[model samples]
Target: MAKSILIVDDAAFMRMMIKNIVSKNGYDVVGEAENGQVAVELYKKLKPDLVTMDITMPEMNGIEGVKAIRGFDPNANIIMCSAMGQQAMVMEAIQAGAKDFIVKPFQQDRILQAIGRVLARAEQ
Candidate 1:
């Protein structure tokens, strides 16, 4: 079966862009959330194979989201998404349990590569 993914970003356009890319690449987008809080809830409900999470959000940030989800499922596969110059927070997200990250104005190849690499790691 195709790997299921949950997309979480405050920007609607970003979510749409990610959905279009992953869906076209044969990954199933199982759910979307506008913030980390909702992403955590959806993570519990959907139990998706992976998650693409945004760092800056209203209620909860990506680092916190990664922590929360990792708290629930220690082996959860999560990739952080951030804009340029948020290197510190990206590092925090990785420490908080995110497997990898993709920078915004997302390059299609980079997104695919990150997702592919993370998912492949999970398989082992």
Candidate 2:
């Protein structure tokens, strides 16, 4: 079965771009969220195989979301996203327990590669 992924991005356009990339590569998009809090809620509700999450967002950021989801489920597979100039925050998110991260503006190969690696880890 294709890996089920939950996409979390503040911009609808970004979400759509990622969804298109992920789905086209044979992953199942289980859901999408606009912020960290919602991403956590959706994580519990969906229990997707992996999550692609943006670093900056309202009502909480990806670092906090990573921590929260990790708090709830230490084994959750989360990949953080970030734009340029946010390397510090990206590092923090990774330390907070994200399995990995991808930088935007959405390189198709990197995004798919991150998801593939995360799913492979879950399989092992």
Candidate 2 lDDT, tens digit per residue, 59-123? 98888888998999999999988885377876788799988878777689998888888888888
lDDT of 1 by residue, 1-124 (tens): 9999999999999999999999999999999999999999999999999999999899998888999999999999999999954778777888899999888787999999999999999999
Score residue 40 of candidate 1 by CA lDDT: 96
* Model number with the top TM-score: 1
Could you tell me the lDDT of residue 44 within candidate 1? 100
On a 0 to 1 TM-score scale, where does candidate 2 land against the true structure? 0.94
lDDT of each: 0.94, 0.89
Pairs with backbone N, CA or C atoms under 3 Å apart (clashes), candidate 2: none
* Worst 10-residue lDDT window, candidate 2: 84-93
The 10-residue segment of model 1 with minimum total lDDT is 84-93
Which candidate's lDDT is highest?
1
Where is model 1 more than 4 Å wrong at Cα? none
Q: Candidate 2 local accuracy as lDDT?
A: 0.89
